[model samples]
Target chain A: EAGVAQSPRYKIIEKRQSVAFWCNPISGHATLYWYQQILGQGPKLLIQFQNNGVVDDSQLPKDRFSAERLKGVDSTLKIQPAKLEDSAVYLCASSLGSPLYGYTFGSGTRLTVV
Target chain B: GQQVMQIPQYQHVQEGEDFTTYCNSSTTLSNIQWYKQRPGGHPVFLIQLVKSGEVKKQKRLTFQFGEAKKNSSLHITATQTTDVGTYFCAGLKTGANNLFFGTGTRLTVIP
Candidate 1:
């Protein structure tokens, strides 16, 4: 099986600019997650989708960050007016709806805000 | 909000020695999952423990879930350079769809 896929391995944007990262989770996965990982820290959940419907987004910065998993297959995370603090790796992962199955993560998009 | 923390933010050990990292959660967890991320790489699934006092082993790595269900630990025997990476413990609380990750423990093995 193919691993989770992400596009634009790297991105650079100026403060207040908008940027979007795309992710394609593993085939047949019913649950998708978006996470932000700062250097030297663990990945923080930004949003979660269960077959196209949001299951969790409590940690997402609604004013600046937004994510959608359309058709329950691929997901996109957008950050509007990106700030210096938003410069981090955006990761995407997917699972089969059961915690025991664990997760398969993507390569992630490394964003740098100037 | 639930929080997960890992001790010894970083650890350095000589090859052939043993290494251990601990993870604690602010609240009881339904299950605990571990992941390993190599330098410049994304996290990869390691193992998951759902029952209290559950212990699972893979090769030289051992994962344990505390009896209280609020803590976990990962132990590596005869560590090797290939074991270098950041170990993260993600806790899933009851009624939650996502797992809360810990601060992570970065391991460096000197050969």
Candidate 2:
């Protein structure tokens, strides 16, 4: 089966600019998640979606960041007015509906804010 | 909030040496999953452990879940250059819906 796919392997923007990332989860997977990984740190969950509905997004920065998983398939994560600290890797992962089941991660989009 | 902590931020071992990394959680975990990430690549899922005091093996890699479900370990036997990467333990805490990943242990195998 094809793995999870993410768009724009790399991105560069200035502080206050906006950036968006897209993800296509593995076929037949019912859960999709977005995570942010800062240098030297583990990936932190930003949001999780079960099918087309959001399961958790408590860590998401609602003031500037938003994500949507439309049609229970593809997803998009956006950050507006990016800050220098926002420069990090944005990872997308998918699982087959059980926490006990491991997730498949995408290549991730590396964001660098100047 | 649930958090997973890992020890030995980095480890350098001679080829053929054995290595191990530990993961501890501040709260009980419903399950734990392991992943490996190359220097420039994304994390790849390795395995998952759910039962208390469970031990699973994959070739030279051994994974263990503590009896309390709050700790875990990953041990590699006869390390090789192919095993050089960051190993992470992600735990799903009870009552929480998201997985919390540990800081990760970076492994280096020198020939």
Candidate 3:
């Protein structure tokens, strides 16, 4: 079975610019998530969607970051007016559901905001 | 807000040596999942533990969940060059909807 897929493996942009990343989850998976990982740190959840509905996004910088999973299959995460601190890897992951099940991750998009 | 912390931010060992990483959660978890991410690669799921005190093994890797459901450990016996990567432990707190990932433990095995 194919794993989660992400686009534009690497990206570089100037601060204050906008950047977007796309994700295609595993077939039939019901949950999708976006996470940010700074160098040498674990992934920090940015948002989670279950069947097109947001499940959680408490850690997301709502003022600049937004995500959507329209129709529950593919997802997109966007950062507008990106800041220098947003120069981390953006990982997209999918799961069957809940913690009892493991998640499959996509090769993240490494964003560098100058 | 919850925090899951992993011990020994980094570990370097001989190819034949053993290594272990620990994870401690601020709150009880319903289940915990472990993943391994090789350099420049995405995280690959390793295992998940649900029952308190549960122990699971995969080849040379052994995973343990604490009796209190707030801690976990991953032990790799006779580490090999192929085992070099960052190991992460993520958990779903009893009432949370998303999994909280711990600071990863980066492993380097000298061949």
True contacts kept of 3: 0.92
State the displacement of the C-alpha of residue B77, model 1, in Å, after optimal TM-score superposition: 0.5
Model 3: residues with Cα > 4 Å off, grouped in runs: none
How well does candidate 3 match the true structure in TM-score terms? Answer: 0.98
Please, what are the lDDT tens digits per residue for candidate 3 over residues B6-58? 99999999999999999999999999999999998888899989998999999
When just chain B is superposed on the true chain B, each candidate scores a TM-score of 0.99, 0.98, 0.98
TM-score of chain A of each: 0.98, 0.98, 0.98
Candidate 2 docking: what grade? high
DockQ of all candidates, in order? 0.83, 0.86, 0.86
**Model 3 interface CAPRI class:** high
Residue-wise lDDT of candidate 2 within B25-97, one digit each (tens)?
9999999999999998999999999999999999999999999999999999999999999999999987777
Candidate models: Cα lDDT each: 0.94, 0.95, 0.93
Clashes of each: 0, 0, 0
i-RMSD of all predictions: 1.0, 0.9, 1.0
- In order of appearance, the predictions have TM-scores of 0.98, 0.98, 0.98
- Model 1, span A46-82: residue lDDT tens: 9989999999898899999998887999999999989
User: What would the per-residue lDDT of candidate 2 be over residues A1-114, giving only the tens digit for each residue?
Assistant: 999999999999999999999999999999999999998899999999999999999999999999999899999999998999999999999999966678899999999999
